[model samples]
Every structure is written in structure tokens, then in C-alpha cells.
Target chain A: MGLPRKDRIRAKLKSENTTVRVLLAHPMHTGRAKDEADTLIPAEFIQDIRCWRNDEEVLTIKCGTATARNPYFSFQLVGGKQGDMITIRWVDNRGAKGTTETVVK
Target chain B: MTDDIMQQRRAILKGAISASTLALVAASGLLLPRQLLAHWPKNAFNAETVEDALLALLGEADIADDAALNFKVGSPPSYAINGASVPIQIQSDLNNIERIAVLVENNPFPLAMSLELTPAVSLPIKSMIKIREDSPVIAIIRAEGKLYKTSRFVEVDIGGCG
Candidate 1:
């Protein structure tokens, strides 16, 4: 289950909407990369991602190994106000969970 | 429109920004589960080909181009020197968008990521993804219970398997 290191979320005011960008710290092994011994690394990548503004869930993303390591995403949330809590949560294929939150600015 | 449909439509229209309205749209957001184990779609993400993946995700429908969808892959070099992190942006003009999926046809697993969006989500979510080979980077938008798709060709100088 050893997979992720940490996760971070950033919320900012942009134009008419508040943009929330999340960065998940993960190795995102495709189960295809070989080691020095040329053995395939078992697939360990994020499978599900969920987002919430304050107490309400706003978005969900399902990702595969195609995503880059340290996956990053930016989504615009309507009515996201400063001081509102923005939470980013994720679970990997190995069943590891990581979550981080920040106040909208 | 029927009374229920009209009320739903009006709810979505006025609910675009309110917290209470977002809760209403979340029921139709396609994200039923809050925890992780039950939600990740194994079949669609693991499919090797695009058609099979789409079949699992969209229930076999004829997808047309919607002029309202604005998808742009940042001007990547003809040969993506850094195939690991390519930038892309998507914004939808269509109404009642429930899902937005980005698929790379040539990757080992074609479906990169699928966004389950609520009415609270505004458009133009810019993101970065890995591209290991030359493939058609496709964006599929599910709006108002219909399917619309568009794609751009991206070539990778260094491939995932090679």
C-alpha cells in the first residue's frame, strides 16, 4: 500500500470564478517501468480523486497510469469565496489515501 | 419541458453559484461514492483501445462535435521533448455537463482521467498529463445526457514503451 507522499491544494480568485488547483504527490507507476533488474514495477497510481468546497463536494476525477507523476489539476468552482475550505482527497490503486485542504484566497 | 425537467433546469441555472444549488446538482454528478474503493472504473481505464474504453464509459453512443466545447492543448512542440508533462485546457459551453474525459489513444491505458463535474464547476480547467507516444488526445464531453467529442493529434519524441 506504500504509494503517496503528500497532497496539496491551492485556491485563488481568477476572473469571475475561484480556481482550485490540486497536486497529488505520487510515483504513479504504470506497472510497466522496469527496475535495474528489468523487473516490472507493480502498478501503483491514483484511481479516484474527489474535491470539496467548504462542506459541499464539487468535483471527482478518476485517473489511470496515463497521468504523470505528481498529478496536478485545476478546476474552477463557482461561488468559491475567500476563507472557504477547499479539500482535495485521493485514493490509489493500492488502497492508500491522501488528503489536504486550504482556504480559498 | 415537463414541470420536473423545467424545475430541474431552472434549478441548475440559478444554482450555478449557490451552495444549496450545488448539492442538488451533485445528485446527478455521476459521483455516487465518497470513499475510493467502489468508484474507480477499472474496465474503462484499463482498456487498451479507445473504442472499448468509450463503450464502457458512454454506453455505445454516436458522439458528435459540439461547437460549444472549447478544448485546447497548449502549443506543444511538434515533437514533445518532455513527453511526461503536456499541458491541456478544456471549457464547455454546453449545458448540464456531467462528465469530461481526456483520453490518449496510444497510451497503454487510453483513458487518462475522467472528471465527474457538478454545476458548481466552471469551465477551463487547465491540467498537465503524460503522453508517451504519438496519439490522438481526445476530449469527450457528456452534457445533458448526450455525448460530444473532439480530439487533437500529439506526437511524442520519446515513447512510453520505446
Candidate 2:
């Protein structure tokens, strides 16, 4: 919940001068079931995912309920050069946070 | 004649009622609690360290097989497995990679990984991940030249929230 997905994406892209892809792991449960304690774990999941390089956003995804246990995403960052960074981040319905970073080389 | 007719009618109704009651009991008997508990895990998949995870993936061969291609994980994991959404990536700089496999150490299944890249794939892939606990993540890449391996350790504070 603390890391930024954009930074994660950027970190991967920065590894080489090419397109970078990322997938965020999220159970994306629909909150349709009760736990062993008979408590309802309300549906909380990533609602949107965005990736950026420098100041420009490379990929923006609006996720919905149909996504599976862990949502996987792939995208391309144009003009990746050495020392550049790509960042990817997502916000869930409950407003939780998760992010990753990749360096372009 | 009225009394005799009433007795026969009563006997038929009793038989029908018994038959239906037995059927209901039989159906309920099959739906037991023990049968439903089969899915619960006795232990949340636990492996002590990253090297242990790699050994589990390799399965007794123990020998380092450089012929096996490998993908490297970033120095630190991307996210905490708050809900098993820890991000991971794999890239192969090898020239003859034909297949790639990922294994999460502390998941319910140690072999909880998959990647089959054709020649068309650029010998690298990256994805987010779900980890049950802190453990090493292993990547097994195979190329025509040989087999190579890569691994990384992730520090997970919380598991996949059971």
C-alpha cells in the first residue's frame, strides 16, 4: 500500500531502452463472501492503474469487478532512454495504495 | 364398508410419508462439515528463506545449471503482499530462451508460477505477484544453449490476508 506502481513501472523500463510492462498483484475479491469468523471482508481492490515516465503518463487503466484474483497488465513506454524512470501505481476501492519502480537504461 | 375403506387409505398415506422422510435424511447425511473443511490449509505455506525456495523449485538437482536461463528480480520487491499483489518481473538476455517459469516460495504451492514464452517473446517478462509470506522468488529460464537461473528475496510484512 505504500509503494507507487508508477515508480515500479519506471524502474523496470529504466533497465533497458525499450517497452516496459507490469502486472499488479491483487486478489480483487468482489467481497461476496464471509470469512471463517463469519465476518464480511468488504470488497476492496484496485480501481485504477496508471504508469508514467518523466512527466507523461504512459498507461492508464480503469479496472472493474470482472478482473481475476490478481490483475495482470502489460504496456509500452515510448522513447525509453538510459537513466529514465518509469512509475506505476494503483488505487483500490478502499483507497489503499500499491506501487513499483523500474529504471530505464 | 366405510371403516374398511378408511383403514386402507390411512395405510397408503403413512407409507408415502415414511418414504419421503427417509429421502430427506439421506440427502442431509451426505452434506457433512468434514467434507467442506477439505479446502482449508493446516499451514499458511511457509519456507524459511530465499535459498530454500530455490531448492524447492529445483527439486533435488541442487547443482547450479547455468544452461538454464534466468530472470533477475529487482533488489527490493515492488509491493507488500497485502493481498498477494506483490509485483515481480523476469527478463532473459540469453540468445536461446524457449521457456520461462516462476516459483513463489511461500505460496500455498511452491511451484505457484508459470511462463512459457515462444521465440517471438523478447526473452523477458514482468508482472505483479501474490506472496503468502517473505520468501525467495525463483525464475527458471531455458534456452537452446543451456539452462540458467535467477532469484531474489522479498520481505513481506503481511501475508495474503488469509
Candidate 3:
């Protein structure tokens, strides 16, 4: 299932730091699940995540199959102010990619 | 009868050629993107031991214990019904912290997750991870180019790894 890019990112500015939280929509199939026909579902998950603030990279997360479905990531960005641009992007094992940008609030 | 047989042979040949062409296209389509975008740490994730994983990913496993790091792990349930998705939070007060990695010592693949942080980002990050069995979850933080580490043992009732 695919979701609108903007819906995945949530960011709020608290004081000088902005807390950016992302909820990626993915099945995160661990390659261990069996379908009703008893067939294994090959693993599919977001393998890499990169976050940027105003074109400067802030965080890079290397994820594995152990990460939960519709993974949630929360981190802080220091020295961010209102209306600062924050962009988050991710790529899954299937080579699917998603990116979203939001202004710091 | 001879003409009918020839027609059937041509049809079969056409089908085979198209099938092979489709298969080749599909295989390349599936492979090209993975090779281009793949950046996951396969060596670290597939490492048999935590030390190997750490060495592969961080180039070292000899992390020192520093009391000033203020490393803290948010508590997880003592007995987890489903170890597949256990919520965990890691935070450190150490300044200039560059990276944080989570490792479950007893899992088949011990390296669970790692986050590289820029100076503009804050210290503590929260996420969910899987645990195979009862094991110590190590949180290693890189601060000022030095590796400092700590651990918390979590008792898992059901193993997550297959």
C-alpha cells in the first residue's frame, strides 16, 4: 500500500530544536511470513533513511528486517527554527523510494 | 498435414522466444535498481558475532566505558509476548555524539540498527527493534571520535529470529 509522501513526515519545532518523526508505510515483510497458500513472503523493508535540514544532511539510519512494519523514527534537530525546511527520504529493499519535506513548526 | 505441423512448430517457437525475452527483461528490471540503490550494511548484518558486526561496521569493537556518556535505554517488558517488534528508546547526553548503534548479543545476527547523526541533530532517538531471545542489548555511542558503550539485558519469552 502506498501513502501520500507528506503524510509520512511529522515535525515540530520546540525551542531551538526541531523534533522530526516519520512513519513510513511498508509491509516490512520479513521473508518469514506465509501466505494463505503457505507460500513465503519475501522480505521487503526500508533499508536506508536519510534526513536533511535545509540541504544539510542531519541523520542517516541503516535499518534491517528487524525493524517493525510502518516503522516510526523520532530524532531531534538542533538549531532549527520556524519555517526551516526539513526533508526525509527512504529506500526499501525492493528499491522503492519515498521522500517528504516539511517546514519546521 | 505437413503444412499444419509446420504452423504448429512456428507458433511454439514464437511463444518460446517471447517468453524468454520477457523473463530476461523482468530479471534485469529486478536487479538493476537493487545494485544501484543498495547501501545496507550487509557485512555487518550478516556477521555471526557482535564483535564481528561492530568491527565490520565501525572498524573497531573495543569500545570504552565512559560514565559521562549518560547512556540510557528505555525499559522494555521483562517478558515479551512477541519479540518481533519490541519498542526501544536510546538516548545519550554525551556531546558531539556522532553515531548510535543497537546490537542484541544473542541473536543470530546481532547488529540490529545503527544511526549516524550530524552535529545538528539531537542525542536520543526512538525506534522499535526485534530481539531473538533473552540477551543484552548493547547501545554504543560514538562521541568525539571515541566509542563508548553500555548494555541492558532483556528477557524475551518468545524469540523473534527465525
Which candidate number maximizes lDDT?
A: 1
> What ordering of candidates by lDDT runs from best to worst?
1, 3, 2
Cα misplacement distance, residue B126 of candidate 1 (Å)? 1.8
lDDT of 2 by residue, A1-105 (tens): 433333223234434435665656666654654689988778766666666676665444444332335666553343467666677777777788887777775
* lDDT at A23, model 1: 79
C-alpha root-mean-square deviation, each candidate:
11.6, 14.9, 10.8
- In angstroms, the error of model 2 at A10 is 16
- How does model 3 score on DockQ? 0.47
Please tell me which model should have the higher DockQ, number 1 or number 2. 1
Candidate 2 docking: what grade?
incorrect
Candidate 1 chain A weakest lDDT stretch, 10 residues: A1-10
Global lDDT of each candidate: 0.81, 0.54, 0.78
Q: What would you estimate as the lDDT of candidate 2?
A: 0.54
Q: Point out the higher-scoring one by lDDT: 1 or 3.
A: 1
Model 1, residue B25: C-alpha shift (Å): 21
User: Clashes in model 1: which pairs?
Assistant: none
Model 2's number of clashes is: 45
